[model samples]
Target: MKDKVKGLVVGVLLGSLLTGATAFAGTNTKISVVMENVKMMFNGVHKSTTQSIVYNGNLYVPAKTAAQTMGESFTYDGKTKTASFGAKTGTFKYLDEVSYARIDGKTNRLYFKNWTNPEGLKFTIAGQKYLHGIGVILDEPYSYDDQTISIDYNLNGGYKKLTANIGIDDYTRNSTNSGSLIVKGDGVELYRKDDMKGGDMPESINVDVTGVLKLKIVFEATLDNGRQIDIVLGDAKLIK
Candidate 1:
């Protein structure tokens, strides 16, 4: 998934999690990434500790486990100096003393800062502007990241997420309105908020926030395994 909050402040360090199947932990460095159940062998490739990056107690490889295993486009550029793999191609760019990735032909940015989480451990994307970030729950980074059965090419396994928008109204100088919501840290979320309750939402439950009102919009979601994610709307402003 791409992080859209590029120009905006990085905000606080959000939580991270994986909501899919068991992780594939391996010790062998010569890892084999199976795409749609077919082995993916790179012709001229370099290798590192393929098992160092663990997800859900399993080593995760961004190249094979996340993209290749899911049958997405993967490539690298020594000239442009970037690495892209899977269903999404990321252009590695440096900004504010940190490495950030951007999807080709899109304004969304994917934050690649090193993440240290408790749950089985994996990578994370944060600070999105326009929604489109994807959560990759991999067992062994690349070896088994997608939710598909190789032998029959059928999706017998995967994960599911619940999403909904939030709204709040009635504004004053310093008001504390109800329906104050939040998106859980583990999964994906989108929050739409303005000075009033009736803020703009791509998929809105309500509309029309044109008045002296203090509002808030939250895009709440629940994962398959009873995990909830809360994404607060970008900003909270004063109704002048």
Candidate 2:
């Protein structure tokens, strides 16, 4: 009886191994995988010539190709892991084992902490928080403080016009401060504003830069009295 039981167990094990081998052999058949091509269009025009790919159930497209489709210049630095557009730049870093790209520049709407002022006295963003993405806040702890904030851009003879939206932060309900917003090219002032109060609507400014080299958007502020004041360049952009 023992020998018969041992024989049945061995036979069962052999049958299972044979079945697995047959399944493995069936998988050896050649199967074609079809990849779908993606088209990226801007203004009703096709942008990509290279096909996008799907990996791990995620669609992946070439960064450079995608940017080119939208008529924006794109460059990558492998050594520094940095990517740059015409006048904008961003860095790629790993955080929590996940990679992220952070762009360094100002846009139409910006948070106080995200504003970049390379040419100005050291300042901080302080005071009651407002939840609108309209402009930048300068100098925290509202007191008598003077500072300048600026945004720099490189034209390379592409854009012909530049526009800026200037205003005082709406959150500063009641404060006393004076400031000026100035646009300069090649160290020459093109436009300046010295009169703006808190809770005031932003003003639109336009300038011709057909033959200028470097463009700078500057905001200068001085504490008049009462509490520290805030000024903002609500929006700035170039147009062809």
Candidate 3:
């Protein structure tokens, strides 16, 4: 079955490539093209299709078919004659690109990057360094009190996924540092990790944010032998 499916072919078109090869058939453009059956596959999996073509040595298929095959959404508007694809897929928007509604329960910090410095935060975890994402010190030096940082985003129900690499920065990797990470969507907890240490590998976070209007991430650190650490959310972004 796999062999037969792998050989499945769609139509392909090939023809002349002359400079004056400009014409129209009915309301659509017409050109000298050869139609053939071509098989398509991705990652050893067959991508079944009924209509496809080869034009100028390139394969062409319906935009909707291609997009859908890649797990993306596609839409067309007849009245406007417009097409839309990949609204909540195959698109990533950095969290820093937009303004947040609050930080640690205060709206005064409209600038999100201030928590990590203007140049952006860099942190090392698992022998690797990551750059340009939200990072903040969770605990104060010599302070026995527990500290927490909460960054909130007003998603406006537009995004579908949230992704980030979470970990403690190497600045305190050698110290007795520990913390908890929590992610919330619309006042509901979506993910949580307790007792994370600075020496641990970065935790890759990829959570569903569908229909989420308000997104919140909280990092809380406990006092351990007067040690401090930078809890980093590296390369954090929202997909829509």
- Name the top lDDT candidate: 3
lDDT of 3: 0.67
lDDT per residue, candidate 1, 1-240, as tens digits? 222212222111112322333323345344333222223233324322232233334433444333443344556555865556444312221111221221221112111222123432222113223222222121112332122111111111121222322222111112222123322212222233333222323232222222312222222222222221222222221111
Instruction: Kindly provide the TM-score of model 3 when superposed on the true structure, using C-alpha atoms.
Output: 0.57
Q: For residues 1-240, could you state the per-residue lDDT of candidate 3 as single tens digits?
A: 223324433221223322333424445767664444544455567775535555677655556565555555767666866666556345778786767787873233222333435344445676666654676675666654437778888888899998888887777787686888899998899999888887888888899999999999887876645577777777788988
List, in order, the clash count of every candidate structure. 31, 3, 9
The weakest ten consecutive residues by lDDT in model 3 span 10-19
Local distance difference test, per candidate?
0.26, 0.49, 0.67
Off by over 4 Å in 2: 1-134, 142-146, 224-226
Could you tell me every candidate's TM-score relative to the true structure?
Answer: 0.20, 0.42, 0.57
Q: CA lDDT of 129 in candidate 1?
A: 33
- Highest-scoring model, TM-score: 3
By TM-score, the candidates rank as 3, 2, 1
Count: clashes, candidate 1: 31
Q: Per-residue alpha-carbon lDDT of model 2 for 1-240, expressed as tens digits?
A: 222223211100111222111222245763333244677665567756555444346554556665566566666666866655444412211111221122123333233322344432222223223222124444446433325556555655555666545677545635676667777776788887886677565667778767767766666656534454556543344656
Write out the backbone clash pairs for model 3.
11-52, 12-35, 12-36, 12-53, 13-34, 13-54, 14-34, 87-240, 88-240
Angstrom error at residue 89, model 3: 5.6
